[model samples]
Target: MTTLDPYLAARIHLLSGLDWDGIADPEARSRFDEYGRDPGEWTMPDVDVVDHAAPGPHGDVTVRVYTPPAPAAGALLWVHGGGFWGGDLDMPESSVVAAELASRAGIVVASVGYRLAVDGVRYPVPLDDVVAAWEWFVRERPAASPVCLGGASAGGALALAAAIRLRDAGSLLPAGLFLAYPVVHFPVPALDDATAAAMRSLPPLLRFPPSLIEEMFANYVGRLGDLPPLATPGHAPLGGLPAVHLVSCELDDLRPSADLLARQLAEAGVEVRAQLAAGMPHGHLNRTPTLDGVDRSLAHFAAGLRALNGAGEVPPDVA
Candidate 1:
């Protein structure tokens, strides 16, 4: 049996009352708020942060722009993750990721708050909000810099969906794609024996059953038959998308699909870099603030952005 890593076990224990059902429970938001919240002091780096709202398909959407110390030459549009039902710009996930990438990666980082599924918004609407933020960033913030798109979990999936929408709409393609353990399919398949066993070893709140995960998918994509390629990037054609950098958590249930994305991208002759963080669980980007694995993952994410964004070199270090 694969021994459960104590680092992941401890983090999982801290996340109580978080499950598929808890997302809709009266206390669901509170639990999600607590689970996704960052607990440490967040000091602003030597950069400028602008918080403002832009027009969206449904309503106004909030976005934060992080200007690096140096002149902005590259830009990354980052989407937050919440299983499609939860997460926001004010969450610790957004604040920490934006600061780390902007200061370390040396590129302007625009963290977007696309509407959530919990607010009665669905697939394309959330995706529309992301594109809206990207448009606003291009027009108002950093138009001259080379651009890349990235997201975490559902946000990652949305990033891909937005890219496809842009492609169909004849918008310019992004230089690269960086996804952190993204949810690519509506009904993510069941885990195999080894992965399922590894997941069971974790705490209850961390182990998501296939049924519960499907429910979350239902909340995002209303009709199963309407599952288009844009809804699930794994099943979509990879010809026109930018080079991909997919960083998946080792113990994450989404690892299988992420692997499929890498394989599909590669088979389609697209440049791809796929890395799995050893012994780490999904959402490590949000959960582990100071661990070496988290640092490495963030650094890799930045590296992908830098490769596409030009020479703004920053080495990986523990934060």
Candidate 2:
């Protein structure tokens, strides 16, 4: 058996005792707040964040815009990675990602807060919010300029789904797509295996059951068999889609699905690039200090954006 990494084990131990179900909405928000409360400290010298609220189909969706040091020629609409049930607009890990992307790409980065599954908002609701946020950015934030869409995990899935919806409806396509270890399919064969094992080896809270995945999907999708290509982007067509960069972790359950989509995109003649992060876990990007995978991932995204926006040249660090 593989020995659990010590840091991962410690994280698991901390999470195990926490009662996620019993926590009130305000408490959960407080916990999320604790993770990334100080945006000023979180911001790098090259990064500046603008907090804005835009109208959505449901209501106003909040977006945190990240501006890099250089002139902003284009923008990336970033979605945070929470398995649909949890996560907020200002989580530290995501904030760090937004800052890094803005700094590296010299582009405007808009981190979005779509409706979460926990508050009766589910599937298409999140998708609607994503689209609404994208449209709002294009209409309101002229400084953001030419736009692209991207996200991690569930956010990644939503990014692709939103792009597809936009393309199908004849909306302007983003310059490119960026996804990091995205969770694309529900009732997957076994995504939580490594995550579950990580929990068992580390402590207790870190170890979650595969069953919970089912519960989350059911709640979001409203039924077991009601799956649509939009919800599971792997099953969707890719012809005429914008250039895409999909990053997946070696130990992540979403690896296989990402692989399948990569193959499909290639077969359809779409410009697509996918990187598999060896030895990383499902949410590895969030733990940036613990993992260097996102470094390479963001550098690649920077290069891609530069190329897409005619922003001059790709950075030397990108492979």
Segments in model 2 whose C-alpha atoms lie over 4 Å from true places: 1-43, 141-145, 189-209, 311-319
TM-scores, each model vs. reference: 0.86, 0.80
lDDT against the true structure, each candidate: 0.75, 0.71
lDDT of 2 by residue, 1-319 (tens): 3333344433333333345564456765465335422212333547777898979879999889888776467888999877777788666447877888787777888899888887667789899999999998888656536788998888888898999999899998887888887767665545456544643443222333567667767877887786988887767777888877877765554556676677777898887776666555566666543234556666667777777678655433221
Report the Cα lDDT for residue 39, model 2.
19
lDDT of 1: 0.75
lDDT of 1 by residue, 1-319 (tens): 4444455445454456466545677676665555444445446667789887978777888889888877458888899898888888876567778878888778888899888887576777888899998887777744556888889988888898888788878997777888888889756766678877778766556665677677777888786676877778777777778888778877877777777777778888887777777777777777544666677888787776775656644333221
- What number of clashing residue pairs does each candidate have, in the order they appear? 0, 3
Model 2 pairs whose backbones collide: 9-202, 16-205, 199-207
